[model samples]
Target: MARYGMQYGPPQRSRVPLVLVAVLGLVLIVILAVGGVLLYQRLDEPDSAPPATKPSTADAVEFRRVLKSEQGQCPSPPSDTVVCDANGFRYTVGRVELNGAHVTEVKAAQNEGDPTWHVMLNLNSEGAEAFTRLTTDLAKKQPPLNQIAIVVGDQVVAAPTVQSAIPGGKVQISSNYTKKTAEELARRITG
Candidate 1:
């Protein structure tokens, strides 16, 4: 007897479309991953944008003697002295021991084995003599008087205490500064 209805095996479905979809998904994931990495790298780079305030050619840098310093608010109408704040302390500054004109070069540099950064100022012959005298006197003093306030445009950048007389004209100002801050300070002083 002949079979009325024909028996057929399972119909084969093409897997090309499914394979294409999977390949496209993989490609998309790789693209997204690469994009994310590139974005992160760009963001991780050091900031090269201009400073908040443009530095002028006449930006003044003064190394002044700290006559008296206190940790509280600065006195209003200071008497025969300039009051400047640095690191939460107010310094009563006296005559300028050194000025910007004495500086020949300024640059930011990192310490040999330290993570902190600093600004180095190279001074002229006159400045070196004056600085030596100032440091020698300050080293013999006590407390606030032993510190020298580095004033830049009315703002005190650092007030480093003098441990001994520095005879050379090379001066390094180190504080709680990052690489960016140190570079900015160098630029401002140079300008």
Candidate 2:
């Protein structure tokens, strides 16, 4: 009771709060130390190397000899990779080049990093002359020379005469090819 007649409330107790504060501080310090260590290790260590490249695609020549159809169709059509008669022939790319204004032979399914599959023709002088004449005719046609197609096994692959005429009867056929396919095309053209 107060002397002035007002009633006084009971005294409030004070709390220490020391142990709670200490525990909280300790936990904070521990978390920070752990975080710093992980960050430092990530930054300091050398980078782990990337995984090596797997041979997802096989060599064109090798694929041709050993290619098989997932569905086992025969006399496979000349598209992408086709297998027929229990054998597979990969239609790889072929390249042609001119040799003294004449085509020599086409280079077939070469591996990556290989020089482009260069094709040269052995067009007899007469053949060379014929090719040149035909090319000129195709160039002058109303439809232009884009229709001039190179046919391989019922497949018309490229029709590129847009740049220049195939001098010496030499031309190139590049595609997703295998060695066997390139060889087969070369054989067919030689005949």
Candidate 3:
């Protein structure tokens, strides 16, 4: 006859099931992490819809007089004047000399004597008169004051100084522009 023996600690168990469960959990976590990254990437992409035919009122182009200007950010609570930025400078702009409504045509062209591109705007008769008067007045003033800020929305695309009274309704804006940039600006102005 043989004597019966008792187990001291826990009974023996296979570790295969536990390992399988752990592996499944790790795979689930990996799948969730990958899905999250993919979802984030998809959400970050820009909308693929076409742009609107007409620009909103806030996006309409305008030419304004530079009232006060500085080499840094515009002041808070800009007061009566609107602030515009161009070429690393901030300008306090006043008075709309011309607006998008007066623009008859917009084109991108190369500079006369330079290898740079520019956006050219042809304006209506009323706009021509207004621009002429504005340029005439500004031409007589000193620095910062002599500049005409070409604004699109609240941003200044260019702030060219009035060397002399620019006669006619044709205006050209040059800001070290590439062909693509000039064309893009023309399109924005046209819209």
Candidate 4:
């Protein structure tokens, strides 16, 4: 006999409800944590933007080829580096004289009412000298040969021809790039 009443086995409390409560609590905590992280990230940058869509497999392959020839297996300093576009058309551009180290700043800008964006590069003294010479030589070439390709990492973002000497050193690459793409180019060049 029990002290207060008839013994009903043991006070069997169903743990199912407790378990459900605990699981719900855990889920809430996880959601809160994730939300907090996302909020912090957004607040931290304020001007943060989403990343652009990645290039296709063909673009990646072509970019890899360009990087390999431009910076990877070069025997000498700056020579003729032959790179192919996504369409497999090859362009034998001058060697990369001014790399990320030579670039001081990179910015993405767009003219009002213009549907396209462009990347601008501010270079150092050494970069300016080498760039001037490269552009000068390219300008003297024929139609398609006049353009100078900007190879960054495994990507060839732009290839525009030099109209004049470009003596001042600030180079603006006009291209059919989107804002995200322009920002990406800026990141690559300012590495």
Which candidate wins on lDDT? 1
**Root-mean-square deviation of Cα positions for candidate 1 versus the true structure, in angstroms:** 7.6
TM-scores of all predicted structures: 0.65, 0.34, 0.63, 0.52
Clashes of each: 0, 22, 0, 0
Query: Per-residue lDDT tens digits of candidate 4, residues 109-179?
Result: 77777778887666678878877887687677666666666765543566665566676667777768788
What's the lDDT for residue 15 in model 2? 55
Candidate with top TM-score is 1
Range of the 10 consecutive residues with the lowest summed lDDT in candidate 4:
57-66
Ordered from best to worst TM-score, the candidate numbers read 1, 3, 4, 2
- Per-residue lDDT of candidate 2, residues 123-188 (tens digit): 546556766765665555443222344433333334444334455644456654455555555554
Decoy 4 TM-score against native: 0.52
Tell me how many residue pairs clash in candidate 2.
22
True-vs-predicted CA distance for residue 140, candidate 1, Å:
1.0
Judged by TM-score relative to the true structure, which candidate is superior, 2 or 3? 3
Give the TM-score (vs. native) of candidate 1.
Answer: 0.65
Residue 62, model 3: lDDT of 86
Q: Which stretches of candidate 4 lie over 4 Å from their true place?
A: 1-80
Candidate 1 has an lDDT of 0.80
